[model samples]
Target: MSLISLLIALGAERHLSSPIWQFNFYYQHYLRLFNRISWINSSKSSASDNDGETATSSVIANTLFIAIPVVACYLIIEALDNSLLYLIVSTLVLIVCFGCIQTRNCYKQYLLAAFRGEPTTCELHHLQLLQDKNLMDMGFGQSLVWLNYRYFIAIMIFFVLFGAPGALAYRLLTKITEQNNTAVESDDIGSDLNKDVAADIQRSELPHAHNQAISVFSQKILFWLDWLPVRAVAFCYMLVGHFSKAMPVWLDDVFNIEKLPHVLLVDVAEASEDFMIEQGDCTAEPCLLVRLAKRTLLLCLAVIALLILTGVLS
Candidate 1:
């Protein structure tokens, strides 16, 4: 069932240039609901607690928010008596959980700008995309590798391991983490504005302590979620790329599973950085990174197919 759903989702994605699930499909609705709840519950201001307390509370709140929907979906799928309907619903859920539509679109635009000799415009767009993925610290070339891991491989592995609920949980965690990172970046901007603006206009609507704690906890949870899958995908990279060059770093970083996926992937991916366009001086790193990632993805698909054929995964 996992293999079948995966094949269907990939097929659907190939035909649709835009992801069937919009970039903000989940986040937009979630934010609206969250704001509504906050408004109704404004009398309770416990969110402004101590750093540790706020962080713990925020983590629990966010985890419950994500897990509720995942459990509901799993229960709904299990309750279905019609096998055909079950397959269709499961396939659609996987499709929605998979793909980084906004990321891919921006990448295409970045490549177009680069090809047109607009380095300034390309770099701006690249930075914007990196910020959206909360990967600005990774730099452009390394961001490409990490994006593949976060948006594709990690989600794929979760689906294969624990089915739709796992995939949904992974996607929700990623979306919420990205949102928190954006908020954290805004807090930095707010600090600069606080220096320049009137005292009344300076203070942010969101409490600093509260927001900071949320960001800290969100980042930690995202790291834990990606730890296992990131290593699994890194191993896939070594298999498809120059193994000798990639393996030593992989071995070293395998112990530090708590580190951000970007740190580990960047070190290893840079080892396979031999691709270059001889005729043009345009950045070919993104292209090469994408090729390497796709090769790893193809190898993953082949493995899944073999497992299905042997009745190891049905």
Candidate 2:
């Protein structure tokens, strides 16, 4: 059932490439409502409490916000109590949860700009992407590689191991962090839908100080949540790419918690594939890295299918 869901979801993702299908449609509305309720309920305590108390309250509210949907998802799946129904619902959730449509579109535009020799446009797109993903400077190819892991591969890994609920939890956490990423254009990628969402969120928002607890907790918890899967995907990179080149870098950072997941993936992915990055040009390298990441994804799925075939997983 899991393997079947994976295949179906991937197929649907390619065909159903509309903004209406994106999870942000529901997330934006859910968050705005939650924010209002949380603010209203905590108005007095927040006014009376110290900074520590307010921060603690913020963390609690954020956790409850993330937990509500995840718990509901789990309960719904359990209540179904039938295999076909489980597969159908999980497949639907996976389709909605999967993909980085905005990022993917922006990447295509970036490539077109790069190919057209419009360095200025490429630079602007690059900066916006870095801002959206909250990443530091890395090669364009490396950025694509890491985003592939973050937006698609990581979610798939969690889905296989835990279920749709796990995938939804991870994605929900990301959306919250991405929401608080920047005050103005915090949209994960520049979707008009997301722009409107960000505008609404900011206008009704409290001060940055109020959201500090959520930002801190979400980043810290997201790191731990991503730790295992990041390594898991890195191993796949090693298997599908140059094992000899990637293995040492993988070991060096395997146990290092301080290294962010994207940084680790970028480093390992760079070693896994060979390419020459021109001084200012970001064209060919991104294609290579994206291809390497795709191969790793296929290898990851193959292993999952093998395990299921051997009755090691169900």
Model 1 alpha-carbon drift over 4 Å, by segment: 17-20, 38-40, 49-53, 183-205, 276-282
**What is the TM-score of each predicted model, taking all chains together?**
0.84, 0.90
Number of clashes found in candidate 2: 0
What is candidate 1's lDDT per residue for 12-56, written digit by digit as tens?
864554422643454454444554565423421455444455656
How much lDDT does candidate 1 score?
Answer: 0.70
Which residue pairs clash within candidate 1? 1-314
Candidate 2: where is the Cα deviation over 4 Å?
A: 38-49, 183-200
Local accuracy by lDDT, each model: 0.70, 0.80
- Which candidate wins on TM-score? 2
TM-score of 1: 0.84
Which numbered prediction scores highest in lDDT against the true structure? Answer: 2
Position 2, candidate 1: lDDT = 76
Model 2 RMSD vs true structure: 2.8
